[model samples]
Target chain A: MTQRKYTKEKKVGEGTYAVVYLGKTEKSRQIAIKEIKTGLFKDGLDMSAIREVKYLQELRHENVIELIDVFSNDGNLNLVLEFLPADLEVLIKDQSIIFKPGDIKSWLLMTLRGIHHCHRNFIIHRDLKPNNLLISPDGYLKIADFGLARSLGNANEDLSSNVVTRWYRSPELLFGAKHYDTAVDIWSIGIIFAELMLRTPYLPGQDDINQLDVTFRALGTPTEANWPNVTALPLYNAINVYAPPSRQELRNRFSAATEKALDLLIAMTVLDPSKRCNSTQALMDDFFTESPPPTRPENLPSKNTNKKQKTE
Target chain B: MEKTSSLSISRPYYSPKELSYLHSKTIADSKKVIYNQRKHQVYQYLFQIIKVLKLPLKVLNTSMIYYQKFYLFNIFEEEFEDFSNIEKSMELDPFNVSLASLFLACKNEDCIKKLRDILLVANKIKDNQIEENFIELQRKIILGLEFKLLQILQFNFNNQISFSTDSLVLQFCKKINLNYKYSLFCWLVNFDLMLTPIGLTLPPHCIALAIIIISLNFKPNDLKTRELSSGVNENILDSLNPKDFKCPEKLVNEGILYILDFYIHQYNLSILNNYLPQINEDLNKEQIFKFMNLKSKFNNLRTLNEHSIDGNLLKQDESLSLFDYSISSKGTSRFINKRKRLLEEID
Candidate 1:
């Protein structure tokens, strides 16, 4: 009989499908054990848990959250993952943490590297958001929560258009495009990049309907002239035709951003997915190589600093 | 301190001899014939279900692999011996096991269908009356067996090395510029290999390359599959390299021999039999004789060397031990795919 390898110390979080527990391995390595709740849904096992195990097992990278081990105890499926105490969302929401130009570059660089690994493997991290980007103790960004991730299938296969959070959703996704590619993830990363600078969500819409209006209002309405097949999308509608933002307008909006930084952001958030820069292209952009190089991982701002200050 | 019972290790690929050694403990000699017969019936049944669902070929291929892999660790059912009276015994039905395998395979392949919907199609195919309580009961059984299926699979979803074998066959054929007839021939062989243990032994890319090599050698010009107008490009075969498809030479050799042996013995029970002519026009003999010819020619080809590993040593291998489904209930059963991680844990 196999004995328990991990001891659950305390419950950290709970979602609809799984309850996450702060745990420790026998070797005293801290880990987060996500105990998936089964027998609750009409389906046998949760699809998210299946997706998590499927992709995470194959992917091994420094910027990707490590799926340490998968074990089952008392019929509950537990995924032992590398313990990440903080996330990009926490840092973004924390007003005390001052954002530096180099700090933002580091986070974005790490995020692109992680996403590049996923895209190269043909697996799209469909739900790439600030919250999904976990920060390790050393401040390395590891892409986590593969519940919504899926490998790119055949050309004719129809993917669900209703994915990615409403705020970070791309223009193509907003128009109900079912055959979008890795560009969708790049769009999310671009929004996250904007959010890192602004210290808040770049495009915070009230609801799904408002998301399109908000997205177009900021990035300008996509038309056939800019995006050739924009009008052909399933939900394509030009209720309000806002003109594309000029370089001066974008500069005014992102006052602290460099010209190269804005260039990469613009390329990533292109309305037409085909025209959008991929992870590889974005990683190779001049913004990443310009002056004030990305801060080292350990030097990045973390939530742990605030905690330590409060205790002192 | 009492050592906590936690088994963390990666299972190595089993050779044919090791596979038979493990099977000997799970299956009795008398029941071997019955097991093969039932497996064939289940394969046909699953194929029907897959067709009705309009699932891709990869889903069917994966489901069959999972079903065969499930029986490797679990006992071959004796209660559900009679296919005609399958509904009589609901507790240990092989059909339920097949359904569970399909369910997991669908999830793994990303062509997910609801378990309830899958059950509706399965029950309808079996001509079993769809009662609400019966559906609910069977659903629970399939759900329960799903966890066991995961345990049997050891939480490893990447069964194929790269893409699914069927897709890789098409991709490799296109890479070598083989025409539609040759590609279809490789695909038909892949369809046949799915029902065998070749998938368990070799990666999909190697199997794909092996099938392509066989198709080049056989040059099935009279294949009955659609779009058979194009002729086989024999010149491309001479320039073929296993490294191009990320397949090792020895593994491809293993796949080539395994596929040939499978067709030589089980040609009558294969999808290839339905498509290809019974008598090979080139060889002036039966189809089995063509496979036999290929087998004799490749008799001295270098393949996976299993000579170093002893059969007695295989018995002592902990990963080969029969999976204890109840182990998770009593203790933790850790599944790690990487051997390096297991070594680190040991350190």
Candidate 2:
């Protein structure tokens, strides 16, 4: 019922599939309205919109973005989402916003918690990147854009490996492993975790092959001994032969991170998807429960104080 | 505002009796029989489309859920007649809506069929020849029905019965060491339930339990004895026995009756199989063409880019026109506010 209660303020962004508009409810609550471009998709609303609506409806958590309402006006499908001002990518790229290890921990904690909730609900956020991790005006991190999210119910079902962005994709996905689990998301979360710490994408590969090279270089090149059934993967033979990195090399790369943080990172970014630390395990790690506590949402760095950006 | 948790009472939580009432209330007295007959015929057509598309049971299950929800939402058409300007052209074409619902379900369930393929399939099924409106119908489904469908669902599209059937089978058959044949029977009964109003009405768990009890062919005394002899807690037995339980008992009993009715109806499958011709014969082609012509009149849509004027005007009325049917009945009023409260409580 957005026609009466919510007023579209301005166009914030536009894409081929959808348009993002800033809107205000009658109570003056700011909301983001994502209008699905009707004529663009021959089929009804795109699968992404369906996935986002379905999962977001079921998943109600602080760290997850809220789907306010869904409506059709004229011919366009509008998704009234909780207005999240600045995403993590914006804040992380902003040089002026300085972040401590605690800040990094806080962001990661929220990310893991969101991912944990999703995983517990049997959902896998296939696309987990900084851009998808939106920030509220109060500095809380919310997981958004469930477009690529899906439930991992049928373990044997061969999913299309062409999911998740190349840079953040897991090694198994890179090698064209069709049947995978939550480890794919865990790898992405680990990369974002590293990005929050380093203030730059850990593996910013230009392409799929390059992504494999960088991934193997960062975490030692996976061998038959380390990752069983590695050679049997679809694209495993296409990989560039490179010497595996040593543990010392990984430590040197993130020298600023504490030992516990490094341990959690190593567990999360393990070469084998099966061995990777899941969201729940990552939350239980010493990085969260021990020395450095995650920063409070209010105290965490905020990109903008625009009153409309304040999320309830 | 009412707590969002209470809004779970809205859907996937409705009792069979409640849903029966909903169906009676939504469908007009004159059109009820025709509507019911048309819905089953359309479901048969959806099955045909599913076979051609080679979609899994999940997509069929999802598509059926969407179809039922569309009719449930027809309830609002009467209450909110003031906003009928745009919705007037949105007539209930069960055939077209069924195809559209399946098209959306394929994507939502991750089957990912191309619109062209879906149109080709629909063309093959409907007329054995392609029609000009097939593409337009697809677009209408995406633009018209999909939005209304989601609004009716409040975006909660998880048809838990399918998933729950699998889990219940595993729990009852493997974990509790229940009858394996009975579990399979229960699983089969679930698909039949989807075709009935009971599918949309009863909770998944209640249906699963009812199926088990019905399939077990156990007398009331035997069920108790099985529980005692098997050393398994009487959880299932208690749930199955209507007297001991609360709200769920009515759901279970209603589910059993529905399943039994469905079994008796299976003999009429031949009659259902021949419904496609009857549907074609019954369709008001002139009325459909008139609605299609009406559709083109509203094609000059207000783009999201042009928003300044609509902004100020919307503030005058608190009731939203964007999707009042969705908002007032099953929108952010419950789900979003509860989430906001949850987030605030999370430190």
Candidate 3:
């Protein structure tokens, strides 16, 4: 707000459109200040930004970052966002801890709920990864960075397959499918789930081509045998048509997860959108319904998801 | 048509201030500053007003959300003043001022207080007087925005589609002690959409998912074989709030929270200066409305789609045509259920 003074603190980060800064309001509210630099991207602000602003503004759950204020001066748009203590990816890389299943469930539950709400509102969180998921010191998982969410209900006339970050990308998206529903999100959730369980990415393909190889090798590539209409996809013709991967390989890769967790994991990451569990169904699975149920936040063993395989 | 609207190639994205300013005067002049203090104050006032309104918290919450979503497209409509909508030849853009839309939502949905009573409280709405034609002007606004609301939200489309799946949804609601239509429909729209993802627009699979999960939660005994049906598997039962349909509690809260969030952003101060015109005239009117909204008025959407509804509607048609006909379609009933429920959010 104009009346409230904003004192820029330190340079936090930078992006395509804006320079990120840490600023404090006159009322002592610490905020993440993003100064939108003009004339950089010929396209100016994208609808993704509007969606982020609107969603952050409307979303007031505890696990969500609160939008403080919006300021425009000298043609620069200043977005004041609630300061999160730290991002999960940062914590995962920086902190050395092994998170138990219970802790994993808490983060997963909170993250899915936040994402599920967005989908219901016809909004898709195009980009979801450990970095975008902010964790408070209290162990609450608040989804931040809506810079890529597109309201699903909006008639985005032209179909574009451009969505999600590479590692977390869904097979349908990778196979060049547009008009994909909320299932793309479920796929991301699957990857996030994998990260939580294995302490590293299950499928880490380098490029789009390598990504497919890693995906099929882990989960196996789709064929007329398993995933019907696989060839109909735009990119289906481009990729090598290989037999499905053995389920035993998947079992071996994710060696530590309980059977119930594996059942839910396989269900969500299924190649078929129809077969894949949407966010709602994923929440109800047996993994979440285990004997002791998912672990409470306080009972979490650790937060690191990048574990190095130990040599015998 | 007003000159405020322009065709949208791509409007500048989130500066936060892109729509923060709200002037005490014209909407165009006042909405200049992105994050001006006055703009923030207006939103604060709106939040306060909605908070104070003694209506069903759910209904108020969703109605405010509808109002907020209406703003998201205002920029689009404002850009294309001439856009024609099939749903309403009136206009496809939302007006800067909602005193009228709010009045209609309250009149039809909330009906909490009389026009005079609401007007007395909302006096600061625009610093104008109660003209004799104010009621009639409000009528035009009711028509204009209502048409836009129907088009943008495509509540009519929702109503049409629900004719098929809602019965399946209703069956599930009955198992959970939410037998009443109010509760059933709320379960269908608010709670169901969140509690049950996967666009029901797809196929029986979406409905199948809902049934299997609801069956598991509602009457796990009835499911012939429920090892793991897509998303709702054995582990899901752990998170279940057994005491009043755990799914309902989680989803209802989600729906209410979303509506609450809608209000916080819907009352944009940017609207204070750049007032979107309330109505549209033909000839030079843009092609925005094009076919959808306008066609709905004259042509027969008839509630049939990829799936044949002849037999389905024929069965329910003769019995409840009286109730269903007054409204656009069964899907309208569903949306009215949602809008009515969400509007009650303030309570």
Candidate 4:
């Protein structure tokens, strides 16, 4: 009964598994159509596509990228998704733009809300990074790229540890803990928070082992005292001992952040996954309730010129 | 609690009376050997695919659902309009559609399988009349029609309250304090219903309830009969609290009558015993090609002749009545309309 007609304008983005095309419906609704490259995946409709279609169909929230429709044509599976203007990574990397700290709060709040909704529905957004967070024309952050999402694991079920990007992966995941929950996503949010404060990645490591090394270097090495049962993990025996950083050293790194904000960030980025602040706890922290409320999205500066330029 | 209620509402499972329309539709014309008599042959094909592929029971169940849902979009009337020469309608061949549904179900269930492997197994089980290349072509048609089939089915997968019947069985046993011996009987009724249109028609819980009620010999009336009336376990009933497991007497009776009718009328059909031979004798490559042509025409796929002048456009009817009424009538109009709109969009 529902009729839709769209014209393919041009290709927008291309990846190994899919190609995105810019399209406009009869109503002139701009849409992004992603066609899953067929005959490449030995399995028809790769698991990632299946996960995206399955979870997106169930989850309908404001901060989540909407999957408009799905259809197969010419033996290729195509997903019709909301066309987002830009991604958070683009904003973070744009040195020409000076972002207010309030803007960072707004983005992180929206991200947490989106991930919270997914967690409530028993889904884990296994992959979360700045690149996967898109900004709409309204400047609202929307979570995109649900390819690695999955339902929460049942009791005694072992999920793959090779999920979330290595740079943003949690300590428990790095230690090869197969049974993990939503704390993995909270850790990524912590890294994003740190990146926003510093205007660069906090711990950008080359590989899984190096990623652990960098994590320990930044946050003290985990021992039985700090993280109970720390060595029982499958890959924990391989972890090299690194001396703990002093409180002053940690304070000096993120000096730009308020003390409360820093405390929340530390809670999120804790070495112990069980002790990490979850989405709800993180949102309810004093840092968010204290002075300098998240910026009103519209009034937030899209791009700011530095005072040096004005003086010149 | 609100989520549970909404989940139930979304699936929209029907009663036997509501699904009886599908039964009549499957019966097709009352004139010749009723298609109802031959309908059971499709289940045999599904069973063959399950056995050959060693698919899980869930995959087989989903495949039957797909097969039943497929016919709702594709009726026998449109398929047999050009069946003047052929004795049996190849357009609705259960074997091919069952194989296709099974293949699609594999993907749906995350049990990935190669198209070639499935085709080989299907060919070996049935008569090898289909050439290997033709089988490949069949695979293409199946995959091509996947989206349309999904749209027609209204994406009903993942909508059910999974294992609701299993819980019901456990609850019933705990209530009566009787170790459940009715599981096998329940499975028998459920699987048999898959072959029939009953699965598409009735809620799984209602079916399970009907089986339990009959096997337990519980009184249909007396709403107050929630307490154990059976003398076998009065002490057990007294020791345990029984959850109210109630169904409308009408639904239980209808379920019983439906299964009874199937047993009396269709139980002795030849296809039930030897469907492989029937599939072999009924299906051939030429018939398949002819059926494909008919289907493509129905879908309004523009074809090229020796002169390549768009064969489909030429089939446009002379009368407005035929053009609008004939094509637009029946439940299949949803598929036709969507396919037309999608084709335009793609172009």
Whose DockQ is greatest here?
A: 1
lDDT of 3 at B281: 37
Error of 2 at A181 (Å): 2.3
Model 4: pairs clashing at backbone N, Cα or C within 3 Å? none
Per-model TM-score on C-alpha atoms:
0.94, 0.75, 0.48, 0.65
Give the runs in model 2 whose Cα sits over 4 Å from its true position. Answer: A1-4, A23-28, A71-75, A302-312, B1-10, B13-22, B25-40, B73-93, B131-143, B159-172, B178-180, B218-247, B264-347
Query: Lowest lDDT 10-mer window, candidate 2 chain B?
Result: B218-227
lDDT of 4 by residue, A1-312 (tens): 233465778886677677888887678887888877656224344556666777787778988988776654444566778877677777788887787778888888889889999888877898888878877666778888878877664444467788898888989989999889998999999999888888888999998889989999898789999999988989897667887777678789988788887888888998898999898898888887777889876765553221100000
Model 2, C-alpha of A262: deviation from truth (Å): 1.4
Residue-level error in angstroms, candidate 4, position B89: 10
CA-lDDT, candidates in order: 0.84, 0.67, 0.50, 0.62
Candidate 4 regions with alpha-carbon error over 4 angstroms: A25-29, A35-47, A69-78, A153-161, A171-180, A216-237, A242-249, A270-275, A303-312, B1-18, B26-60, B75-96, B109-142, B145-148, B154-157, B160-347
Per-residue alpha-carbon lDDT of model 3 for B70-175, expressed as tens digits?
4444432233433454333223323323443344344323133444454444544545576757644444544445444433342222221211333435544445
Instruction: Give the top-scoring candidate (lDDT).
Output: 1
Would you list the rank order by lDDT, best first?
1, 2, 4, 3
lDDT of 2 by residue, A1-312 (tens): 223367889887776578888988888988998877656444556677778778887788999998776655554567788888888887888889899888899999999999899999999889988988888878889998888888885654568899998889998999888899889999999999888888898998988888888888777678899899899998888566667666677678888888888899889888888888888789989888766688999999876643333211
* Displacement of the residue B16 alpha carbon in candidate 3, Å: 29
lDDT tens digits by residue: candidate 1, B1-347: 53334574545366777789878877789989988887888888999999999888788888888887777788776586666763445646788888998998888877889999999999999899999999988888888888888887777787553478888888888888888787878888888877787887888888889999999988888788666466655588788988888788999999999989888888998888998887888887888998899999899999877787887788788778787776677766777777877666557
What DockQ would you assign to candidate 3?
Answer: 0.01
**lDDT minimum window of 10 residues, candidate 1 chain A:** A303-312
**Candidate structures ordered by DockQ, highest first:** 1, 2, 4, 3
What global local distance difference test value does model 1 have? Answer: 0.84
